[model samples]
Target chain A: MPAPAIQVDNLSKLYHIGASEQYHTFREAIIEVASAPLRRLRNFGRASSSDSNIIWALKDATFAVQPGEVVGVIGRNGSGKSTLLKILSRITEPTEGRAHMRGRVGSLLEVGTGFHPELTGRENIYLSGAILGMKRTEINRKFDEIVDFSGVKKFIDTPVKRYSSGMKVRLGFAVAAHLDPEILLIDEVLAVGDAEFQNKCLGKMDDVAKSGRTVLFVSHNMGAITDLCPRALLLTRGSLQADGSTPDVVSEYLSVATPDGYVDLRHWKSERSGDGPMRIEAVEILDSKGARAGQIQAGEPIRFRLSVRGKSGAKCNLSVAIRDMMERIIYNPNTSDDKATVTLPAERAIVEVSLQENRLARGDYSASVWLGDAMNVTNDRVHHCLKFRIEDSSLGQTRSKGLVRTNGQWSVQRRGL
Target chain B: MNPQSNQFTSAMTADESAPAAPSEDIPELIIEAQKGWIPIHFGDLWRYRELLYFLTWRDVKIRYKQTVFGFLWAFIQPFLKMIVFSVIFGGLAQMDSEGFPYPIFVFAGLLPWQFFSESLSRSSNSVVGSSSLVTKVYFPRLVIPLGAVGGCLVDFAISFLVLVGLMAWYGIAPRVGILMVGPLVVLTVIASLGAGTLISALNVAYRDFRYVVPFMVQIWMFLTPVIYSVDIIPEDWQWLLMLNPMAGIVDGYRSAILGKPFDWSNIAISAAVALVLFFVGAVVFRRIERRFADII
Candidate 1:
């Protein structure tokens, strides 16, 4: 199998939780080292050990990939996905084990890693190419292709500061796509950019894979992963759980992810947007029978209840956003859409939204809650606040090719004939 | 097309062995936990030399962009500093200029000192300022600080022309001694790079260095003999004062441009000290480079 394109063995990384936070000056760092013995003596009688501060970001990860294989790495947040990519890109050293790869390696851990805002688009192309390990001659040869691919030919000489964010991302992707390395390591850089550009990138990646190169794709978007990769690896809590066919691995992941088809967000403790005047206390999904349901069948009715609190007499425009497994916003039902603003009392209130017929395909989906005011300002919002699954229905429904399914009538009139 | 599609489908099910990658005798790279003190990888640096150039170009372009003066800002900075120092130290304090006009003498001193100080401060902060680039990609981390120093060299070159004009205004003709300016410029860059690399590496670990640098620069300027000549210092104390590497570089510039006698003893001591500092900085920088992405 051509010596396996890449081989990783017993790879691990260690991180100190709070220790890495207290940044010290050069003098303080020196002083700490000098007083290490004293500090150790002072803490000799402590009951609980201080080892809780240490975490294994990655622990004894072992894997291998054949040449020309496209493998997807999937994991939740803090599952060591980023750490693994960083190690493979050599951005940081591994604390244990090793990774070996054949041929020239190019990693796109971030798009436009070295693009300067002040430099002209043309100059940034060359600069970013060089930063990605492209030689001058190679860039010269592919310069026109890159400019054409970016579709920024008219403004190629203008500084990037004036370019739209989409234009910049397009130009950045163009340069990275033309790297032509033997092994490409890409993180979730495709999560940005417009849909058309993302499709173009996926097409390019398909071409790259067909050209006899290897790819290691890491993303939380299962649709993109399944579309591009034939094999998949699942990582959970810094350990490899499954490495098999894409569908099997992905199903295993989803089944483990939303075990009961729902995640309660009564005490979501992460950072969210908006002021303190409004807050989302809880989110619940109910079935047609008015009972809490984890999974709803396709085309079935579902209800979303957002328990919100605000000052008395304050008005809010409550909304719900539903995203498919690919993390793409498929549906956003907002009170503002209908210009129907609701008034909330000083205490707590429940905002209910009912979906008459859910058209989501058979997959895992996430729902978010948003509370905004009349001024179009988001007063409170929480993302990925609820996870639920849509089970397959036996109504002989025609499968759709998109995130949502819809029924449309089509008839051909023979008037012309 | 139908037959081809059928063959493709059949092949997909028929083959059990993975397809071989296109092989071209490419060597494999093994990445592991690095240990011990490895020397600088000159080969790797050579491979990434283009990135260094591009980074330098980026810094130079970004510095003058959206500015009214553009490159003129380079000249104005040192010229204004020269004028201010000439007024305060020369006119008010009555500092000695060692037989040359105070303006030209102070201008000559400011040329090298400005380059050194600018390069040092820029280099020291380069790593921290580019935390995104450092954390995102893998190249020689030293390129950041080195590129910062390189970008400041353009400013030095621009200001050097103003010094020549000021010397001409004073009717100080060029001499063979001016040839020495080339080596002295190199010495200044090396010294700045040394200190800059050390501080930039430290800055990643301790952000306090960012606040400390400007204050240190102010104090360092008073000690570098930019406004006054080193001859004003007592003879015995001169040796101690020359311990500051920039003292020797400023002295060299004044003597070389003003046609004064070069202080060989003081220049020798400063050159030795600057070389030592450069090596020490490089060592410390290399030692801490691995931890930069993690800590920062």
Candidate 2:
């Protein structure tokens, strides 16, 4: 057999919490180094043991993908998915072990990563393409096609700052999608743009996968993963928990649970997009009786309690979406649907949404919460941050056929009596 | 360039053919944890030369984007500095210009000195300023500071025109030794890049370098013979001044442009010091670069 396109062997990365922490000034670094000797003497035993400030972001992750294989990496926030991709792309060095790639590699850790605002769209394409490791000739050859795909031809010469955010995302994804590398690593960049553009990106990615190049994709969107990848790897915490067919790996991922019935959104590390005057602090799932429950019957009432923390007198529109294991929205409840404006009285407040009856099919599900303003600007969003299970109704345990159970009333009427 | 084009063509062909096509032309990449003091990878730098070009181009383009004066600012800055120094040092202080007019002499020194200082300050902050690129994309980290330094060459070229005009006005003709200015300018770049790369890495590790760099650049200017001729220093102590790489560079520019006798010993010492700084800078940058994406 030909050599695998990518081979990762026991790759690990240890992050120092306080040592390389952000916002550290030179004076603090100097003082820390100066006091190192005395501090070490005082905590000699603790120093020799395990330092509390150190945490492994990735540990002993070993996997290999053959040429032309498309593999999806699925994980919760801080599950080392991005860390793994970062290491493979060589954005950040691994702390231990190594990885080998057989051919040229291109990674899209972020879209529009190096696009200078002052540059025109055409110039940004060249600049961003070069940043992503594309040769100038290659970009020249694909320039027309990229512009056509992005649908930003009218603004090609306009400065990028003038383009809408959606336009920017489309242009960015178009450039990345044209990168004809032997190996491609993508990290949740498809989570931007409108649905039509996202579909176009997925179609382009499909074409890329069909071209026989190896691909490693990371995304929180399970539906996209199932659509694009045949095989998948599941990461829990920092370890590779499962690697198998997409179905099995996704099921394994969905079954991984948070403690109790609440997820602490305050410190959760997920791909969050928004400027925040309002933030989601935590989310709690409750059954009909209002007690914390990890699983509810298909017909039982479910309530989502969202603890929002923000500035006093801030106004927001809160929305919650329940999605199935495939990441398809099974149910959506929005405060704006009732024309309700949620006003914050103080620093923290709990806003709860109750479903009178959960008609979701018997399967694993996750809740994504969103906070936005009247201007349609997303103030904060946490996607699929809360996971729970829905069981069959108490009458009989029958597997459902689709994403939701039909609750239509049955009325028999004879048309030709 | 030939090999790279060949690789690209082969990669394209491989993409079009069957998956199992036995083309062994594809290069293998191995990424391992870097230990202490990793050696510089000149090959990687060469391969990423296009990115260096684009980054430098981006800097130049964005620099004067909204400015009304645009590229004229490049000429105006050095010319204004020359006038101010000519009045303050040449007229008020009566500092010695050796032989040439004070404006021409000081302008000669200012040319290399301005390039050095501008490139140094920009490059020292380049890694921190491009934190988005550093943390997201993977290229030779050396390219960031190198591109910053490269971008300053445009301003230097523009300001060089002013110096040329001044020389013509003064009716001072350049000799064949004027070709030496090219090597001296290169030496200045080396010195600036060395210091820039070192400070940029430090800036990433300690943000306080944000305040330290400009202050350091101010102090560094006084130490170099920019406003005055090196002859002002005592004969024995003049050797000590050459230890500062910019001193020799400024002296070399004046010697080349003014057609003065070259100081071979001073130039030699300056070249040696510049090389040493470059070596140290590259080593430290490479050693610390592995952590840049993490810390930055």
Candidate 3:
């Protein structure tokens, strides 16, 4: 019965807002203060000052984590993820409920939290370490390692304001990493660094997890979350939506977040909304069976099925895009040679464009469909309507590392004199 | 494994109690072990008193760093005000200082008022000014204003020493009542913190506190008997004005620094109001402290 690393129960936070309901002038304030109870009694039948501005950031959120368990928290924006973290971290008190945590909790909610512009990077390391709840000896023991890890050795003695943004973020992260707290709550801090730096951070976090310290990681990057955390809790619109395996939750999240690649913009929530009658009806990625979904490899065989229609039966040039999660187009299939014309029957038409092998790395990507009139007759239409996910594993279900193990040929040769 | 690893015995006990967390161990159970100890606790504030000291020190250092005249800024403002008051009131208005030199009368009043005004200005905007720290991490929200208010003591000391210099040049000696300077100084600090905390908390919710502060401080200056003696007011009306907490504190400062009588009746009223203000300010601050992270 190892004591659980963290326990939270029946937590709820309620915020009361103010309306124009004024609290009397000075003379009236004195009289109101004297008769507050009487006033309340008189106006008990109706709400007076507050016009129902009570918002609950969390509602009965109860969960616990064991020691050394690295759990990913998956949630949409405003899903109470940040609020839960804040309350647990004690940035603010839970409106109702108690959280019992064992050991110091180090949080990287934001980088460079306490760096004074006038203080040197070296001084800031100690200052931030202390703020993170590390003692002097604790910081002293790991000071050199933190500096080395941050790769800011050259700028360690320079004032923090003088350091580059990367240098500042690195120093802030390094101090947080070396804190050695029993529990760590990190909010996508690795997001600050470059790809190589991010890779290095992932490796370090892997080591942190292996060291048997409990960690709660929150990130919108499903790849990072799925790679690092085995278990995850998903929140939607402020309630616990799903609590299960990382792959399961992420897959669930992606399905719900499937951008309104649907043909009609009104029925669908389109990412790109704009002028005139131009809107994406639907975007479908089908398999050889013509099923709505096709299991995809990063850069392998796949098909794009677009269903777009214009207000009139006129022919329209089609433009399709394959954008990665960061919104960079990984593949675009709207060139002249491979183009297909669907004399859209007035209101609706289906266009299917299939490639022998879809070349993409294993991850989530969005399928975009756009429509314009023939001979440059109308405005351009670009909309991300449907969501597509590339599974690295033939297992197709496991979200293991967000990265797939691609088969590449390699050989070693030696030259002898 | 090391021979003393407690490997065999520890493993056996692990079944009964969590090994990493020593549920039965007195020290291990100090903070709750679930979800990692609540990221913060009210008790933690008491534990981290040294951090508060260092933060206050940081504020003082940061304020003085890279400035041209360094600590002299503390003395320069009050000294300038003292001369201006002495010239205008002592020379032109010819207001009596109860026989003591006019500058001495005015400087003693200005000294506490200046500390009050400076501390209030800094503390009122302290949370908003440090928005970088407030919204992201959790520390006692009280620390920002406390540090800003506490940092003023350094400036107060620097300027207070100048008063001794001015008194020496004037060849005036203080009476034994100077011992009351310590309590009077404390009273002044309490008055400013009470006002600053309440205002700063409100400042976060309504950004209008930014516009209101300098305007309020400007008006507050006249309400207190800084430029003139409280004796200038007819005796009957003095008690009514003493409701402004600084009135008693500023008057008390003049009493201790100069040889004036301790105005106990007025001070008693100010003490009651100051204490009430502090309690009121603290209540307002605590109630709003939780919302700052979300709203601010």
* Total clashing pairs for each candidate: 1, 0, 36
Each candidate's DockQ:
0.50, 0.53, 0.24
The docking category that best describes candidate 1 is: medium
Score each candidate by Cα lDDT: 0.84, 0.87, 0.74
Deviating ranges (above 4 Å) for candidate 1: A19-39, A42-50, A262-286, A289-294, A303-322, A328-362, A367-387, A398-417, B1-27, B36-38
| lDDT (Cα, tens digit) per residue for candidate 2, span A18-112 | 64475677788788799989988987666453465577889999999999999999987788999999999999999899999998899999888
- Give the local distance difference test score of model 2: 0.87
lDDT of 3 by residue, B90-208 (tens): 89999878888899989988999999999899999998887777877877777778788889977898899999998898887889989988998888888888888888887776677
Cα lDDT, model 3, residue B97: 85
Candidate 2 DockQ vs. native: 0.53
Q: Clash pairs of candidate 2?
A: none
The residue-by-residue lDDT of candidate 1 on B76-188, one tens digit each, is 99889888988998899999988888888899988888888888899999998888887888898989898999999988899999988997788999889999999999999
Using TM-score as the measure, name the better of candidate 2 and candidate 3.
2
Interface RMSD of 2: 2.1
| lDDT per residue (tens digit) for residues A1-417 in model 1 | 369878999999997766544576677778879998888888888854557656788989999999889999987656788899899988999999999998788999887778888888999999999999998887887787788778899999999999999999999999998886678899998887989999888877776777678999999888889999999988876888889999999888776754543454556543355655777887888878887776888888889888878787888898888887667788888888867788886578888888997888877887878888767688787776667888777676546766688878989877874
